[model samples]
Target: MKLSLLLFFTCFLYLQILFSQDVKKQVEVGIIEHLDEFVPSDIQLMNEDGKMVNLKDQIDKPTALIFVYFRCPGICTPLMDGVADVIQKLDMKLAEDYQVITIGFDPREKIDLAIKKKKNYQSLITNQNTDDGWRFFTSDSANIARVTEALGFKYIKAGTDFTHAATVIVLSPNGKITRYLNGTYFLPFEFKLALIEASKGHSGPTMNKILQFCYSYDPVGKAYVLNVTRLSGTLILSLGLIVFLVLIIRKPRKRNYPKN
Candidate 1:
């Protein structure tokens, strides 16, 4: 009976491991990083005012490009809110040093919806006069596809909704991809560094890279939690340091003999 119970427990553990691996694979498939890739400027999109604008014309300064549908039932709102929070905390002047562009990825979404959504986020910003610094756009599927492809963003439709990763793409003044900030919550310092790098027309690593190595995003909780693998690594490192210190302390000091 005990042997049977042990076998059952082992099978359950194996199944849990397989399930975890599957979930990781699903999350990873929805992400693609196009670091240093140049976004095509010729694609056309309708601005909030319903004016036709070329993608290239709007990116005169370092830009933060966000792709989300205004009507998304999940992830989109929190992602935009996170962006607004970061923008408000940033010391940089909008439009002068950098700007933000939010493009609705759902082709069926219209200019009116885009306008309304823009207004919602704009109201969150303290500087109302800097409205020009943040622009919202809606366009046909063809144009949307071009931009998403260029940025290496991939999304899959699930019923009437979409499954996608929360990301912010930082673009250089010339529209080259500089960095990607993953997850809804962003660190202001890392964002500021991204802007500085983008302004220089170069891609640089985000400050969160090392932190991300130690944590994994918890989609259900909408936060990053400690990753077991990295936590184990950290524990091993600590143990090694402790062992080294013990060995050094135990080593006998050189005997002081009566030297002539």
Candidate 2:
């Protein structure tokens, strides 16, 4: 009887772990298409300078919008670094052609923290004039919810931290969602195409479809891991072939093209 009880208890624990994994998979899959949706213009946030401003005012040109909290211990730093690297590699001017905006999703995060984060990333950029082009913002929970919901940016708070997907939203000049780029590492050519599409007020294809099958964040590891789920293997190979064909057909453009 003692041995049987111990075996039952072990089985119960395994089942519980499997259930939790299923729940997490559902949550990750919840983040999906918000293409062509216009962001909430009335939502107000405090900029790095601690000045109250409407969210729409800062998006007069193509903007790469990122939602992250300063205290995030997981994917936030990598996400910001990826964007900074893309900005440095791009041939286009920052403020003149496009802009980058980061908003802290945690209401507890203060403008001082935003300013400090801004300074850290700004130092990485080689273009001095791009200083004003990149901005950081913090806002109250009410305003933050309004914008996050509009963009379909789902995040769940766990104690003092939040678990959210690592992705970037490309917005048009007038604050319309144009494209979604999944994961931290972005190719410069794909990023340039996104910016060009956004500048012309055109929405691009969702990049998350292929990414979902290829990677999933491991909360315990605090990093992305290979997604070896049942159906992912076949989908991964199919997407790989499609990407290869697309790349072969697309010719590389000279980096000297005039900025919009």
Candidate 3:
């Protein structure tokens, strides 16, 4: 029984590893988040009018910030659509209660593309001044780096495209990060609450990221791959636990004794 316990514990320790080598190989380039941290002051972007503007100067109300390129072949459009849908459904008035700012992370993109995208998404919502609230932009790579790094939005360029997480960053009126909404779709209730909290300068961590914990982002495939190592490790550990229990619970066999 002692030997069995020792073996089980050894297996448990081995199973817990789940192979760090896989994590080391996979680049962790998603939203790391800097809750309550103020966005850096100097990050500049070229607005739809082709004029340079400081990002900090634009935040008079709660803002939802997004990072994307105009030419993305995946995820970006759906994310923008989700934001537009939420905006259309929200009871709070747009441009008066809150605003959305989207930045094209690729420095090579120009403000003209941003303007076209603004119009494209603006068409999705009605009965509101979409032009004023849903703004798009482009910036040089340096400014892009500064803003993304400050907010913990990480991405990698891959053959003219990029690999990034789909998320919207909520910021307070004073430019402090208040929340992050992950994934392509936004719930109107949650979106409204995030904006409401931002208005009050409240910082909160939103973790609708169970899939991220269970999966690994595959840069080459541009999809989330299951972390088999973790699953396999857990399965092995479960088997070991069962074996340990059996060893502990089963009665020891008694040898027949001759009449003394």
Which candidate number maximizes lDDT?
3
Question: Ranking under lDDT, best-scoring first?
Answer: 3, 2, 1
TM-scores of all candidate predictions against the true structure: 0.71, 0.76, 0.83
Query: Model 2 over residues 81-153: C-alpha lDDT tens digits?
Result: 9999999988888888889889999999999998988888777887744567888899999999899888878
Candidate 3 residue lDDT tens string, 1-260: 78877877787676545444443334356787799999899989898788999999998999999998889878788888898888889998889999999999999989988888888877778866788988888999899999989988878878888888889999999999999998888888999999999999998977534455567767776666787887786777798689768867786888999998
Q: Residue 104 deviation, candidate 2, in Å?
A: 0.5
- Candidate 1 residues 121-238, lDDT tens each? 7778986344788889999999988888888777777677666667899999888898988778888898899999999988865534344345665555644567887568556655
Sort order, TM-score high to low: 3, 2, 1
TM-score (C-alpha, index-matched) for candidate 3:
0.83
Candidate 1: residue 8 lDDT (0-100): 52
Error of 2 at 158 (Å): 2.1
The residue pairs that clash in candidate 3, if any, are none
